[model samples]
Target: MEALTGCTRDELIGAPFKNYFTDPERAETSIKLVLSEKKVTNYELTARARDGRETVVSYNATTFYDRDRRLQGVFAAARDVTESKRVEEEIRTLNAELTSANKELEAFSYSVSHDLRAPLRSIDGFSQAFLDDFGSTVPEEGRENLERVRRATQRMGQLIDDMLLLSRVTRREMHMQETDISALAADVTGELALDNPQRDVQLTIEPGMAATGDPQLLRIVLVNLLGNAWKFTSRRQHAHVSMGTVRDPEHGPAFFVRDDGVGFDAKYKEKLFVAFQRLHAQEEFPGTGIGLATIQRVIRRHGGDVWAEGEVDRGATFYFTIPDLHVSCPVKGKQP
Candidate 1:
């Protein structure tokens, strides 16, 4: 009080309480409000010093009573919030600037992808034309070089597409609802089988598995996981893949996808969810390395968590949870 009003205790003791405030009427009304409301908290006022300086103050006041239960007076405390308020405004300004910068970066990425792809398609198209027009005239090595060029172009295109998808995953507006995890897994697995009919993989989906999330995003998660499972187990004579829900001691229920495939090293599991980070050689298993990163973003947006456990050459399991939602729901039968 002495610092705010620039008055000693002796001068403050019997002076009009409102005189030290810029808005005397509001300051006086604040005490009356406490008497009626029993208490008033975080009431804002501007304290005026004797040197004509002002400071922002927050007042918390309560009504007091005498021994006979008669009204006595109001007891109030004031705190300077000038620095905290300034910091809050600064944070708001920084957040706005950050949002603008992100939008600009996203736009730049899209423009670069579009410009690069045009030339890439032209190169591939002309290379194919050359092969078609002068196939016999060109040497075998020359033809192989042309094919390599085409392959590189195709791979670059795929990388661009995947990068765009990863960007969209973070910027997309989510629509949360009760999603059927079992049905989504079944659909994704069925698609994988159709795409590679030669592979005889045993797939199991626990029936009635459900959770709350964006259904479209959740489907992408299943497609990426099940696709990886199917790809990694291509060499196994007896491959097995399954999806189910398990109760987590720390985070309620979690949904899991398990695969008896060429699992990765557990020590490097953290790399699994970082964009463009890969564990295995590109020749061994082909991928853009954006799948798990996308899955982590989706789960996090739903206020949940995702993790993995695996051992090299053994198998792997991925687990994710949606906050406060159950994964076990009753349904008719199993999906295989």
Candidate 2:
């Protein structure tokens, strides 16, 4: 009691216990409960120190009996829980603040998607109308300038759409279950092949590669990754793309998408996952630079991480791990 209350043991030996309580009425109620129940486990109260500082304590108490079995007094032991209570309060405050911030962000994203895109549509529409109605009457240079303006507005519309998708990926709630990753990858690749049948790309997907995650979000991950691989390998005479899983000693099962295409420099790897950050020129490869960032958010929400390895002009391999899915062996062929 002396160590907890900042009072000397000699001064507290016969002092009234009620005098040390911050709330005398509450302390009296707790005493009554202990007396009636014959014992109290972890009853909480605030005790005032000699210097007027208050400390929260959890007390375990029981009635002390004399030799004749008559109740004499209460015997109790208290453990200080002031620090733990403070930590719990801090956590609650942080959670509330985070929720409020996410709501505000969602509202802002909605405004950008609808309000801003309306004017952009008007700009692109009028530019197209000018070219269609007065294209022959206008000079060649003037007509090309109108075409440039239309293209710029179209690109701006694309940027806005991608930004909304990135925001949705961050705020959306996930539904976790078993997902067929191999089939998803194959579907995305098939779509790419159908869109550009002229390109001859050899895609090898390890069959039956499975994991536990949000099936929808994981599909988005495969689309972006495989889409990038398809786009970058467009110039290759024979493009080679593969999707499979590997066992890592430290990270457990890791999935990868590898492509033999135009790869980026290792020095710029850190910027690969940042929104609006592009390592390659727009003229070389067209992208709004939001795909990898969206993939990173989805993987992180599932308690996983995504990374890449590549050398200039060689190829790139993207690897991600879902820690929640304890997948050990390969679904088909031997591990790579």
Candidate 3:
């Protein structure tokens, strides 16, 4: 009691235990329960020190008896838990604040999706209508300006949609299960091929690659990565894209998507996963620059990390690792 409560041994030797507690009522109730039950574990109270400082403590007590089995007194041990209690309270406060912040973010995303898009839609709609209704009356330069306005509104609409998707990915509840990543990659590739039937591209996906995660969110990851590969490889004469898994010594099982495309400079890799950060000009490679950011958030939510490696005009490979997956075997050679 002296060491735990900062009281002198002589002061605590004959003092009532309840008298040392900050809340005597709670201490009395706990003592009664211990007496009735014969033992009590982890009964918590605030103990006041001799200098008037208070500390949280947990007590374990049991009734002591002699050969006749009649109750004699209580034997107890106290552990100071003030630091642990403080840490727990801090964690609870941080969690509450984070939840409140997420709610506000969701509300803002909702406004962007609905309130902002309505006027953008009207702008684009009227621009198109004006072009259709008075194309001959307007000068060619004026018609081109209207077309530019329509395109800007369309791009803004895409940005809003992507922002909403990013917000949803962050807050959506995950449903974890075994997912066939190879099949998902193949499906996304097939869709890409259908969208650009004239383009010549070769896509290779390693079979039997699987992991444990939310299938929907994981599919979005694959779509964004594979879509990026497909988009960047558009100018390649012999485009080659591959999706596979590898074993990382530090991060466990990792997945990758490689592309022989117009790869970016490695020096700018740090900006790849940041929202609205673009390394390429829109005319060179069109994107809203939110895909990689969204992919990173989804992977992080699944207890994973995403990274990329590339050289200017050489090629690029994106890698991501998912935790808690039972990797069957490691890839034999170096990663692409």
Candidate 4:
């Protein structure tokens, strides 16, 4: 170390070098860069001594040029960051621990699913029994009251199922593969047709679309996306819906679900992907309200993203991305 700085090797070996450093690689690389292309750049590395003491530093190396553009020895300035790096690593470890803890909590919540549903069943059964035993004696309004009790119990059961889904999504397996987006969309459309055959509406899907992701989770995402599209666009005489992709120069490619129906305001976009958040009235739209939240979670778990755009009584488009490795989605092909 001292030899490089014009000092005796023995003296440089034991000096307070932990706070001082010189990167020969930085010097060499800088020299080559200036001679070849002449640019300023920086890099980080560690320097260790014979005694095992070490220093971490980043070298911001630059080339010096004479007014006539004559070559000069590259000058390097280093910033000691051993402590900073240590703290940064500590922060990263803490964050990882926090994420794991969050997952564990979700697992714990899922475990409660078994315990939670039993009581709802008891309530529902008891309510039905009361109606059956005293139906002839009970007034019409009294029978109606029992019906409401049964309805409440069923609703609570549905809520527990929703909770389970939300937790499972947090720790679900992701298998990435090539998928045809158009095929998946077509399959969803066909199933919706069978599921709600009475409804008279047009469901149009663009062709030749593709993507890469976990097929299972992506199917859930599509089901929710298309389901919402179908639900919101129901009011229209001829529902307008499209599925395709767009190229973003800086951000690569993004796939989207476009629909003309009951669109929401831009202000609530962020809240759309949150659990149990519904922008519309329950009377107008019946949902457990966790669909979008689950869709967002699956998308994120696959290392992708999701966003939406819309306005009241206008239309909406939701754009999201997976890995773009494969694509799959066709009507008769409602995922196996």
Candidate 5:
């Protein structure tokens, strides 16, 4: 058998097959893996022929014993898969092209939405101005109808704005650079302060910390995280908000926004990041529900991620990452 199959049949007669293809140290590790897998001892592998050519082989080898329960020799067989491998490479190339096309389409659709927003805003604005200025001259019930029309137009306009923003997020090119996370937080806090000067809230931002990410996108991320923190904790006795970063292996570094606000169940964390998805009633919290969805897109574009943790009436901590900005991505053309 050894002479026919080029195998040292004497060596294979009793000992384990590990002494063959893989080295001693590797064989021990491989054997442990096999034991842990608890699968049948049948697998396909590659080996070098006597002519030094590579051949794919399949073998079924197992433990054996005599009627006395004593160990016995193992037998093996094999098959080749060189043609199968050639077909697999062709399929992989096709799949890669398909993925590239899909990514291009997503980017294009986003740009188209952004470009259409300006015209929609003008139409809504002019209709409102005309209704408000000339309502007095119109008939009583007719004027009321015009006011309703104006309000409806404004609401639709806001919805369009949100949709456009969400689309632009997907298309926009992220400009990665050294970004001051604390400064972005502080700036957003200040803006929130100016927006709601009457609300006295204690906001703490850890200074001297930074992240590598696009400044503009980071602003959007900070605005959503901090703004949610501010709004949800608005009615608290003494509102508190904190911003800081934590170490991560896969994402490098992660920044988080913490607040003592009306938190939610952890079960719905995934839903919170989806577009147009909201967990709270509109009356409790006024929002387009596009914020977190946009945040998810931004983090992903930077090769990062976002997640949240909270309890009902306790508070929520939102964690997000910004990839190292120094790295450059090729401007591969994307579709609309």
Candidate 6:
């Protein structure tokens, strides 16, 4: 208190207490309030030091009485909070600046992606038209070159669409609720089967598996994981894919998508979830290399983590956990 007022004990002992504060009227009223109400806490006041330096302080006071029950006076203590207040203001300003920057970045990404799509569509359309109109006149090499142009345009269009989806993953609002993991896996696998009717794929999903999260996002997670599993297992005469949950000692209940397919090196596991990072050749697995990154973003938004375990040519398994969301189901035995 003496440091805050910049006064010696001798100089302050007989001085009027309210005179040391910038607002003498408020300071006097605070003391009267403590007398009537018995106590007051965290009453903000600006204390003017002897040298005219002002400091923001929180005053806590209580009424004191004599042993005979006669009202004596109010005793108060003030703590300097000027530095803390300054830090709080700085934090608020930084948060506002960050929010503004993110909004601008999202807008820029959307505009660029939207602009690129128009030219890509035009290129693909013109290339197809040329092949149809001048197929006999063009040499064999010229026809193949036109086909390559169309393919490149198609791939570029997919990449642009994926980039936009990735951006939306961060910007979209989440609606959390109880979602059935098994049902979502079933739906995705059914679509995969219809798309690749020739492939013989065996899919097993554990029953009654559920979690609390955005149903739409969770379905996307299944689509990407199961779709990758289905794609990579294309070479196998008989492919096996499974989905289930297991209790991880560190992460609690965890969900997984496992497949017996042409897997990747374990060393490149970290690269799998990074956008545009590919382990296999584009010819071997056709993708925009953005699926795993999208899955990571969606899982993280729900306070979860996603990881992969794989070995060359053996298989791969992806595990994700949503902590604090009651993600679990009763496993009777091993899933067939």
TM-score winner among the candidates?
A: 3
RMSD values, in order shown: 4.9, 3.3, 3.1, 10.3, 14.8, 3.0
Candidate 6 achieves a global lDDT of 0.88
- Candidate 5 Cα deviation (angstroms), residue 116: 5.0
Q: List, residue by residue over 1-336, the lDDT tens digit for candidate 2.
A: 887689898989998777788988878888888999999999888999878889999989999899999999988999999999899999999999999999999999999988999999999999899899999999999999998898889889989998899999889888889888877888889899999899999989877778899999999899999999998888899999998887656566789899999989999999999999998888889999999999999999999999998998898999899875533343324346
Give the per-residue lDDT digits (tens) of candidate 5, residues 188-276. Answer: 99999899887878988766667677899888888888999999998897888988766545555567789989998889988998888
Maximum-lDDT candidate: 3
Task: Order candidates by TM-score, high to low.
Answer: 3, 6, 2, 1, 4, 5
Q: For model 1, how many clashes? A: 0
lDDT of each: 0.87, 0.88, 0.89, 0.75, 0.72, 0.88
**Can you write out model 6's per-residue Cα lDDT over 83-112, one digit (the tens) per residue?**
998899899999999889889978888787
lDDT of 4 by residue, 58-139 (tens): 6566667888988675676667788999999999999999889988887688668878888889999988888889888999
- Model 1, span 183-252: residue lDDT tens: 8899999999999999989888888788878998888888888898998998898899998877766665
When 1 and 6 are scored with TM-score, the better candidate is: 6
Work out the TM-score per prediction. 0.76, 0.84, 0.86, 0.64, 0.57, 0.85
Tell me how many residue pairs clash in candidate 2: 0
Clash number for model 3? 0
What is the model-wide C-alpha lDDT for candidate 4? 0.75
Q: How close to the true structure is residue 143 of candidate 2, measured as C-alpha lDDT? A: 95
Cα deviation at 187, candidate 5, in Å, is 1.3
Kindly report which residue stretches of model 3 are placed more than 4 angstroms away from their true locations once superposed.
Answer: 1-25, 47-54, 247-253, 325-330
